[model samples]
Target: MYSRALRPCLITFQVHGRHFSSTKQNNRRVTVIGAAGGIGQPLSLLLKQSDAITNLNLYDIVKHTPGVACDISHMNFPAKVTGFTGPDQLKDALRDAEVVIIPAGVPRKPGMTRDDLFNTNASVVRDVALAAAEVCPKALVGIITNPVNSCVPIYCEVMKKAGKLDPNRIFGISTLDLVRASAFIGQAKGLNPKTVNCPVVGGHSGVTIVPLISQCQPAVSFPQPELEKLTKRIQEAGTEVVQAKAGAGSATLSMAFAGARFAFALIRALNGESNVIECAYVMSDVQGTKYFASPLLIGRNGIEKNLGLGKLSDYEQQLVKAAIPELKANVATGEKFVK
Candidate 1:
């Protein structure tokens, strides 16, 4: 279990060394916007088990939100779980939520890009985001829909129009990329994957997802040929899972873990603990863009500090330079969708 009680400071949040107030203690509600799909199902399961969560709200456009809630309710977890289905009840589902995660959208098919999945998922995300603004404007919103490079902007546009947009309270969930990067790189290096904590920055998509290998903790080494092979593998890790599922699903289980880690950190921040830091995609002015993803100092209210891209190796620097075009395009795509 990740701890939500880590020392709360403006320190960069780490998944290690954390604790949560789980004993019928904290009375905060966590609502998952899309709690029925491949990612949402397992992601909801994880959240239901969170000590920081006293109540859990499951919302979905699919007709099965109630069933999903029924299914997850069997778990002997302490948190109260409720399901809200269809459009009419969306606002009610978000009521009084402290944390609202949007994992409610389409998953990628075998040959689909995140952008391809966005065409349908974008509308889905917007509708939920609109409800979030109306019912739980103060909630920390964690977005997990596809083409997050774009959907996050869609959420921002919704909240902005509703006049409830808070950059610090909003985040794009790119932790999966970081998880996959660490796992793939650790496997390539024959090291334990748990020991690898590679912070992936930039947007979430094909080339837009850039992993900063130079800054991997505990210091891992790969030769030139190995570096290229490993980087490609890390970059393409999602594809490996998608192909492995063979049309059954995308990377849901691992994404759930990453999402939980993020949630735990937020809970820790709320608990007034120190030294809780994690890399997440957030609205950033660290560079030229209105938003960028990097390591952030998450505090009680929202983002405490926007840690700019740290010093990268020559190879990593090259990746950052190469990724700008893709990142900018992805950001543009999301912005246009909202417009």
Candidate 2:
């Protein structure tokens, strides 16, 4: 169904067998905290196709939870599907999972910024994230909740209070920005997005999203004005999707693709894959902030190495400078939520 309607741009990178990969396809349970909405539904569907997952549980307050569960269960993938419709059953949905991807909370709509979503989704994601903290304390959490710059700090603080927060294991899924930047750049320059890598840092919200196009590998130089246009385009890609959708929702299908891509990277790292790197907003001291995004090397234990900000072009440096205040403000928002 997804293939017929939603084009899958990501090509899976897998090294067959459990000895080299983290995918057990037997006992490892993975859970989705909010699996009913636009992002969640597509993300869950992507997870349904993962071989590393043996059990897939979904938690959502929506009434259609069981129907979504039933629908996903029909997939030929080996994972078993279960749905928890409310907070009462949230524990059941989260129990003993090795990985949890939270795409819960409201998406950005017309006239609202991702930060504007903080008022509504902050508590929703925090509450659901706390359940994962309690039920699967050690699970690697890939947070897809918006205001991610802030919500991640919220997740960190709440998990800390619950005595389950692992700095390395909790990641704010910022792969979408990188995905979007690469796609946009690729389209304009006619390069394959899969091979064009751009390092996007700072935060996941507007103005806070900093794409280091200067540091792109297999590099190409953009004329100064063209560079500014490309950077602005990458930064505003979320709003581009929103305005194009005309109040329907934010980037769902593309985000779903990015979510799947990040999830697969996590699975590979856990399996001891070497040279695995993905960008995510997470706790870091690389830029004087408690959390920042840069390239991170993943291994059997989540983040094995934090690759600090590499050399940037003068224009890129200014972009980062401009983004810091916005990113810092966003981080402070989530931190306050937890505090």
lDDT of 2 by residue, 188-212 (tens): 7889877677778888877778888
Q: For model 1, what is the error of residue 2's alpha carbon versus the real structure, in angstroms, after optimal superposition?
A: 20
What are the candidates' C-alpha RMSDs? 4.2, 5.5
Candidate 2: RMSD to truth: 5.5
Name the regions of candidate 1 deviating beyond 4 angstroms: 1-25
TM-score of 1: 0.91
Expressed as tens digits, the lDDT of each residue in 150-247 for candidate 1 is: 88888888889899999899999888887787778778778877766777777777666778777776467778788877777777778888999999
> Would you give me the overall lDDT of model 2?
0.80
TM per candidate comes to: 0.91, 0.92
**Best model number under lDDT:** 2
Candidate 2 lDDT at 309 equals 76
Residue runs of model 2 more than 4 Å from their true location after superposition:
1-27
